[model samples]
Target: MRSATESQKDSAVLAELIRTLESWKETVVIAPDTPDADALASMFSLAKAFGDGDGRSAKVSLPENSLSQRLAFLHEWANLPVATAEDFARADGFVVVDTAKKSRCNLREDVPEDWDRGRTILNIDHHASNTRFGTVNWVVGEASSSAELVYRLLQAWGWPIDPLYASLLYAGIHTDTSGFSLPNTSKSAVAAAAELVERGADVVELGERLCRSQRLSEFKLLRTIYANTQLAADGRIAYSTADYQEIADAGCSAADVDDQVSVPRSLHGTRLAMLFTEGVRGKTRINFRGDSGVPALPLAKAFGGGGHDAAAGAIIAGPVPEVVAQVLPEAESYLNRLAQKP
Candidate 1:
């Protein structure tokens, strides 16, 4: 982890990035990882900052089906150019936001093996496990969300916060912090939220749109997961699984089911919750959530996945039943250790 002083130094890097961006004569392409609201919002916001200037046009690129219905507003939501990697290649420079690792960008297959290295690549993210793989990396793991960093950067650059940019950034911070219920949330995050609201973010509307709004398919998927939820001894650990067939029957996409897996974790007595979903590529996606300080990331990493302490995931090759059978015991053991904490 970077010290407070080191983090301050990292914040300084954002100014350097602005200077570099100002000096650039070519078009800038802002790309974000797939299937994430925070990433999408950050990409669009940053693109707006760069494109609003003279001799500079910015485009936002993302993989297909990366944005969910809730985030689909961002598509028709803005006038910014949204395109794929092919369209991005036409730009002179690249600005990658919200994603620290190249693998997470879902661009690995699309990006050319030998792309131009001299083209300036600015990487900004808030993930603790960031790879820092960019010509210019501005990673602040402590920033509540990448959107928060974008808001700060915009402020530093003296960019005005329009309603569209403000709303998108608010959604990003809201989702990433779980509505400010997460552990790492800070005063800056709240202040950013307040400023966004003042800039016409429409908090009530966004809340209703994101949280209260749910498709029928999503409800059906949640119903299935609720039916299968099982609690371990003393209800300390909860486990649930949804097979591919069940998911298909619910008429829900992977993204819809993605969040339902965490339902088991909401059990009042549960210290840990595990959800296993069968993926199409002969893999089972496991999501872990816990209230205790068990640090699920290390365990997720053991299975070739990683995330924060309270939330983490892994993908294992096998049938859903087999995967569940393999992981449940491990999850139980983890809860046991957490319970034994002095």
Candidate 2:
């Protein structure tokens, strides 16, 4: 864990980021990767801050078709523009929030090379695996969510946050921290939530909407996956999968199954859990979750993807059976290593 001084240094970077945005005279584009609730909320908040300051014209863009229906209620979702890397090239400045790496941003392939080299690029995120790819990086791994970081950014800039912005930001923080139940929850997280609530964030209503609200189809899919879960020989490893046909039968989208992947991983006796799902174009996405002291990023990197120590993911080019056959052995070996450790 970083000391309080280290954390304050990370927080101070947000002030520098605000100074950079304040000096910009040309068009600025705010983009977030994959359009998840956290990404959209953070981007929208930052865009509002930029627009409110210095008469600067700011636009919000995302990779096409990335916004999920579940998060359509965000205020900016309706009017937010969709732009590719080409549009980004012409912008005076770029703000990349929620995602820190180009691979995760899903930027268009046709964009010009070196498009962002001369432009000021500010990277803001809460992911521990962030690659620090921006000219000005405000990566705060200790924050509960990117929304929390965005909230601080708004405060530093003295931007007014109304109820809508508060709700959106609260949703991002709520969802990412699993309602403050995840291991990363912190004192600053609670303080941020309190401030947002005072500014008209409906904690109870938002909690119900995010946690209690779920489609019936998602429930059916979760049932199938839970029923098929398997525990390893030592009972410290668990694995589950949902093939294409099963997904179709449940009538649920990939996002619905995304949240369930971590359930098996959280079992009391399990040191690690894996969930495999069939992805677009015959690729299978494997999500890895592990307890403390277990490294999941290296394991995920072996399969061409990367994430944090406790949670990671990978996409493999193969059928579910082949992926499971390859992945299970690695997970087992990892468990054995843990057992062999002093």
Candidate 3:
């Protein structure tokens, strides 16, 4: 639940978003690099809120030819089109959902650096580190996911929640909250989820798609993950590494790896878990998941990344071994310092 002050703030921002929607005739929705299920659902749900008898045109820009195999259904179901220069030039406004910064957006190459200028940009996100780049920013860092923010906004605007959008929102919330295992899965988040389910969301189908099933490629990656897993910092830290070749040999992309850090994190005494993936040459991506009293965001920020305290990531310019060597010590030092604190 929001504190009194936070509720007022939410009211103000939500009012701003509603005003933007009422004025916008054509809205374009976009997400960040390698958009996840939460990002996709947030963008699509917000898009659906645009056109119901309002005569407004709202479209989601995938900008990618394909989704991860797990999300393959979105190719047909999302009905998103690849973004083009004309789309941006013609859009009355744009909505960037679930992204923390402009640099991370998966916009077309022709999109301007100061694109938000002279435009009604709605920066709807649930990341505390969001730059507030939107003329109308509705960031709820305490919310489980951007999908939750969309639910609240649409509910406030009296936009009916279609069954398909409800299913997407529910799936988005579940994944972003790590199946409600994370600390950010608050009572309100759960309540929002319940409402989505009650509103005709297909929980059983979404569960099968998102959780109960994995692709053959993902199973291959899982074996590789298990083989590379390691423990450090007196078992307070657990980590795994997967290089480009290993992932390629597994017939999987980075998105196919299902938060494998959770494997190490499941250790009885682990305070921090990391998955170092070398998806691109000379660049290593790190996923950080932390237990209570151990903040993951600080470590991510130290490496020029950002997300929630319980879950965050950074893409560093280094090989897998070098990054692991560099990051593990910093993690250990941080844990050691925490141990010393009163």
Candidate 4:
């Protein structure tokens, strides 16, 4: 929890969000195109909490292709309607969650440009790298997940928190903190999680689905990652690359590789881990995981990406090999500098 002084500061920003919701007739809640559990949870919670009263409802704008089976059980996940560009363009205002900059939202370039003019955009997130692109930006870098921030907002506003909302929020906190194992896990995050459990969030089921459950595809991808892993910068940096063809040959898809990047970082000698995977439309997606001594945000920002200090990602136009060749030296150089630090 924040001190009394910090709480007051947070209240001021949240108050603006509450006021903005009350004054707007129609609002659009937007999450990043490739949103995680935290992003989806925040979007759903804000939409449900703010739009539930008499004649007040918010539409959610998300990419049609963004849904994942991992969260399909939640009512909020299954029922929340997806929005088109038209909905985004015509909405009176936007409540953007779990994303910092407008570009990171991954909406069409024209959509954000149009939405930015004379419109109210609430940029809410937990990334230290947030650019505060919203008219009312409420960013808490120390918060574990955006869902944790949403939980506080719900409590402050006296909004309804049923089992569905509680479960969604729990999933956000649970996954983002790697089941409370990551360094970002905070007391506030743990407290929020406890409240969600009290409200009947199914923590057991969430664990089974998010942590225990894994597909054969994921195992296949893991094999590829292990086989291809390489070490550099005096073994402080570990990196690997997987192309679409290699993943397909293993009978898996790109999604299976998403969580495998962190595997290398767990090695005793490694302080930073990287995984590059070929994405559709000639883009290569790079995922980074770092220890306390090695921050990933600078690497992400260097490639026009943004995320937290320990975990971040970027998408580069690629031939996967070329992208690897271009980034590997930079990664080594950064690690070398860290090695020389006092």
Model 3 misplaced stretches (Cα beyond 4 Å): 110-114
RMSD of each: 2.7, 2.8, 1.6, 2.3
lDDT of 4 by residue, 1-342 (tens): 578998789999989888887887777888876677788888888888867867876777665445544444553453765656677766778889999678767464445556656788988899988899899999998899999999988887888789888988999999899889999888878988999999989888878877777666666777888888888877888888788788777776543455678767767888889989874636888998989878999988899888898799888998688999988899888888877899
lDDT of 4: 0.80
The lDDT per prediction is 0.75, 0.74, 0.84, 0.80
The alpha-carbon lDDT assigned to residue 101 of candidate 3 equals 85
If both were scored by TM-score, which would come out higher, candidate 2 or candidate 4? 4
Candidate 3, overall lDDT? 0.84
Q: Per-residue lDDT of 1-342 in model 3, one digit per residue for the tens?
A: 678999998898889888878988887888877777898888877876785536887777676533577876644565655557777878898999999987888776677766555888889999888888787888888889999988998899997787887898888899999898889889988999999989988888888988868888888887888888899988999999999899889898765654778878877888999999987778899999999999899999999999888888899998899999999999999889988999
lDDT-sorted candidate list, best first? 3, 4, 1, 2
Question: Can you give the lDDT of residue 248 in candidate 1?
Answer: 77
Best by lDDT: 3
Query: What TM-score, computed on C-alpha atoms, does each candidate reach?
Result: 0.89, 0.87, 0.95, 0.91
Best by TM-score: 3
Clashing residue pairs in candidate 4 are none
The whole-model C-alpha lDDT of candidate 1 against the native structure comes to 0.75
Off by over 4 Å in 1: 1-4, 25-34, 108-118, 338-342
Better of 2 and 3 by lDDT: 3
Query: For residues 295-335, what per-residue lDDT tens digits would candidate 1 score against the true structure?
Result: 77767876877666767787799989888888877777766
